[model samples]
Target chain A: MAPTEASERPSLERLLATREIMVACGPGGVGKTTTAAAAGVMAAVKHGGKVLVLTVDPARRLATALGLTGIGNKEHRVPDEAFAEAGLKSRGELWVAMLDTKQSWDDLIARHAPDEATRDEILANPLYQNISGRFIQSHDYIAMERLYEIHSEGRYDLIVVDTPPTRNALDFLDAPERMADFFSSRLLRWLIMPYRSRLVNVATKPFYQIADRILGTEFLGDISEFFILFQTMYDGFVERSRAVGRLLADRRTTFLVVSTLESVPLREAEFFAQELTSRHLHLGAMVMNKVLPEYLRGSEAADAAHTMAEQAGELGGLLSERMGPAHEPLRDSAQVTRVLKEISASFLNFQTVALREAEERDELSVAPEVMVSVPFFDTEIHDLGGLYRLGEQIWE
Target chain B: MNDLLDKKLLFVTGKGGVGKTSVATSLAFLAASRGQRVLLCEVDGKGDVAGLLESPPTAFKEREVSPGLFAMTMDTEEAMKEYLRLNLRVPFAGRIGPVAKAFDFLASAAPGVREILVVGKLCYEVREAHYDLVVVDATASGHIVGLLAAPQAVNSLVKVGLIRNQTDWMLEMLTDPAQTGLVAVCTPEEMPVTETIELAGRVRNETTVNLASVVVNRVLPELFGTQEEEVFETLTRPDVAAELELLVGSDTAPVLEAARLAVTLRRTRSVHLDRLREAIDPSVPLLYLPYLFTRSHGLRTTRQTATSLGEELGY
Candidate 1:
């Protein structure tokens, strides 16, 4: 590694400056979507590059956070005025989109089917509707497929992807391969063999009788028919899946594993990092979000405690004066000390959280090159102002 | 807790990162403490329940993580194998590598099939009455509705078959309020609360799973009354330094700053909590869990949370 790369932190600004693609991945509730949106804003405003953020969760969370209404499968540009209000004089634009799994599935079939007849046949199939419409992992496969499709267009300088929740994050990576394998599997091919040969159908009648006893005749026919139609387009689908695999493996694409200060997400991050390494994907940065700021620690903590103890009487007087005769019980010195102590305790709690976050970061020495930390925010971050403020922190 | 414990199956789900694992573990522990045999299951192979219970991770096999409490992770493949062995009576389904591979292909090729196997297995467990209560720590809230509706979706799609019969049985168990309950977990934040509200509506309309309650996790305490908050706000001003000189006879800047930040966090949480309270339907019971300030979310902290939650439920 270059000395510059070795020494410099893996901050969002660096990623925005150079990387074409950034996939924000982490456990659920770690603000992965928020981080991805913030990074997109950072890339557009600070780096003077056009950015696109793609989110895969069915919820319109990114759309809601960006203050955009009704995000569908298509790219919805965040208006210039929203960015202007955020005090960002960006030379580039930011566009956001949510993945529509059903739409993507239809689009994939439209692209890969050998002919209109075959496409219509497959799309009209009941099994195809159930599989393509409700297949849980299809979202994962189609998300990557959409990413590959959008990236090839060269429309945006940077694309930030908000992945599915952590529990299924790896599915997004593996589903494409699994989809391709399922299509090309020998078992499926053999199951559909009778569809191509009348002679084989005649020979397999007894076999069908026994199999129908187990899987039912209607299901057997549905499976065979669905596979026969799907088999016609198998080559096109497999090729696209392999292409998506290559695109994810491209050098320009990077992954930022987002986690929080806690043990569960950090442990999940470690597992994610290992999987990325095993898959030979570029692990760009490890972003630990929601880290509590270290307000008071060690001697400063003691100082706050001492100051609270000294000011207990005056603070009591202040609250007593404010509360008047109705709150006489609250004016006691003992009550005052308890309130002040709570304030100090909150600060100390934050200090402990911050320290623990640092310890968790230290444990991630395996992928120590690009690490960024975002502090926990007190206020809710919604709309352009929040994104801009969060983007500034990400850039920092 | 009694209402939830009474159901043979309880499915707990929430937005990503809303502490569903903790909530599920706490509920299971609470039920087990009430002397009910509780089986806690997690889908998506996260092993969060196992991790929180400080037990070694077990996939597809229920292990006694705590007394009267069992934990298991539902693997789609394992569920598929189990479904075949029990329902189809395929003798070699469990051990044959080719059969497993073919089953994986079938599941992958069909979208809702995997969900059926996993959810069907869960519903099957409930029907079998192996445990007095079964708690499934389902996938995040976003996908949970889809998981719950899978059996019905498959049932409606397939006309007549062994698969249909299996799905029909699972659907029957799922929709019966006496047989199943759905607990939605959330944090007092905009996204999680909004998602939880949406999930509640979906659960009511789409699935037979009863919306038992909403567990709001990681809530901060409201430490400041209106007047105290006003005083705190005034103290944050730089001019308060003059008053500090006379009162404490020293720089109270640290004290004021710490107090202000702490109060701000509480105020933020309170505002969000208000939003959550308003947004959620009043008919639904809202349970709040305080944020634990421990360094790690280990077993002891989890047990402490469970105890507090049990007390709150009056179990």
Candidate 2:
């Protein structure tokens, strides 16, 4: 490797070329999923290897373009024809998969259960059904668990995982540990002991009595039954979760914190980056998406906008007189004035936001090694071509 | 159509960073300014509601942040304690520390336990007639259906628990259009719009709550009409642009380019806005809030949002 390459500032391209895993996460509505897909695309295009993007949910068009629609928990390759259609060629293969939480949970249960009967019983359990399908927090654990499963398979050279939109952004990071602790906790044993032995001790009688009344004895019994069945797979679950934790903290894994320049998402992203650093996880790059253009921040633009807004009528008159004979539309001074005023006012308005974005960028406390900004695209990024366009902006 | 503020409870939710807190705070402000006693609850406990209101951080205990306006942050453990005291008549003073911890663990394991507590507390405020209106800054779009459907989930699972009995009335209040409604907030962007549309469908089919309205925040101003747009195009032509630069005594390209960017942005957003309108039920009103170009967010932004919300509500 060249010395210049070694000393160069870290970029997403370099990060992707080096790391085996990139976890894209931050606040919702900040293009985390799309950015992850773009990064995966860039990796496949620039580096010759198999790259897979594991996204929780994608827009319908993007899903269709990636052939991800109705294909849950299965990785699919993006066809060469699709790349041709997008006017691009990839050096390596690009793959996509959507996280199917319930399917992942069922697979986990099947893998860990002591016997087929126990696996079927747990799958049939109503509480298990609800926990697997309806529980929101279950998503946090299952996503990471699925990633661990896929990574262990060694099918893809690079895996870009888009995390679920969690209530707290850090939930998935703590999920493996929490899952391990949940099965090992003494409370689980205490809560299920009576059901297991059919005896409530004198010291524990009051607690069970209160619980029985509040939860109803039958519900308590059901809960105990569920936990009792779950307890059978405790060892496997704990060991698997610990392995998942190690995988996240591994040197080959890196995190890409994605956010917009807006204050709220930026704050959340900053906090997420700080937490990743404190946890000794690699914060490889920060991708700021949908950022306003730099031209909006130039003093020359502000000066021009100020003058235009203040002297709109005079400028409109001067321009209309000079150009009205050639262009019929400019003949109307009033319309021209309105246009100039609207243009200047719009510029100033966006300038205010642009300047605020600069401040927010400056105020970001946690600095990752590489920070890249994706300029706002006028149209939605819904296909490979659009993704390629976005990928190119941050590739360097 | 029913007036929005006339409803006893309103849950405002959206994808994060789309100004969910602002809409919730503004709705509370609008209701309070109209002399209604409004209790605003933040379910995520982010303290964003308090920050938007320019009030001190709120706890599970409601505090009057303004005249007729009360604010609180949801703590599921505190709610469980209150439920135990009020319904079960459990002695919560002595053993609650440990008992609540144990219940917290159970809640974490149980699918709907934590969600039920949140919905239960909000319903309790309504059932007690403590406030004329209760506005919840609820969970994001992804988790909201689970939260709102918790009662039905608990009801089907628990059969005969105290929670089962509690969910009946809560479901009654939630399903009733006169008493409760959900406002889905979104920006005029691709993901937010898609999520909002998907959320509306889920809230209708999965949960008992009514989709009362969809608030589209950050609708960028349309910079030109057809005739004026032609004029703008003329102004941007190199020859005309150069003359305008000389007339303005500065480079006018950036200013014109900014306008072009703004126009394209608004045009692109209008497509999503149209899709949102077409996807959502026609009966549900779509309220548009203009993008704020303010330097900072605080009470001022909240008040401006409230004013816009008022105008949209035809106040």
Top model by lDDT, which number? 2
lDDT of 1 by residue, A1-396 (tens): 556662165566776677888888878788888888888887877677678989876346456656587888999888887777766677788888988888889888888888999889888988888777766677778888999899999998999998866356688889778878877776676678764473356544444443465457677778888888888888888998999888889988999888886887788878888999888898888777877665544555556556665566666566445543443444454454456656656655656666777787877745734777787787877777787788777674
Kindly list the per-residue Cα lDDT of model 2 for residues B48-112, writing each as its tens digit.
Answer: 88778889999999999999999999998898888777876765487666777788888999878
Task: Provide fnat values for all models in the order shown.
Answer: 0.39, 0.92
Single out the weakest 10-residue window by summed lDDT for candidate 1 chain A: A324-333
The docking category that best describes candidate 1 is: acceptable
Best by DockQ: 2
What tens digits encode model 2's per-residue C-alpha lDDT throughout A30-62?
Answer: 999899999999999889699999999777777
Query: How high is the lDDT of residue B197 in model 2?
Result: 92
Give each model a TM-score. Answer: 0.90, 0.98
Leading candidate by TM-score:
2
Candidates' chain A TM-scores = 0.86, 0.97
> Against the native chain B, what TM-score does each candidate's chain B reach?
0.91, 0.98
Q: Which ten-residue region of model 2 chain A has the weakest summed lDDT?
A: A195-204
Whole-model lDDT per candidate: 0.75, 0.91
Pairs clashing in candidate 2? none
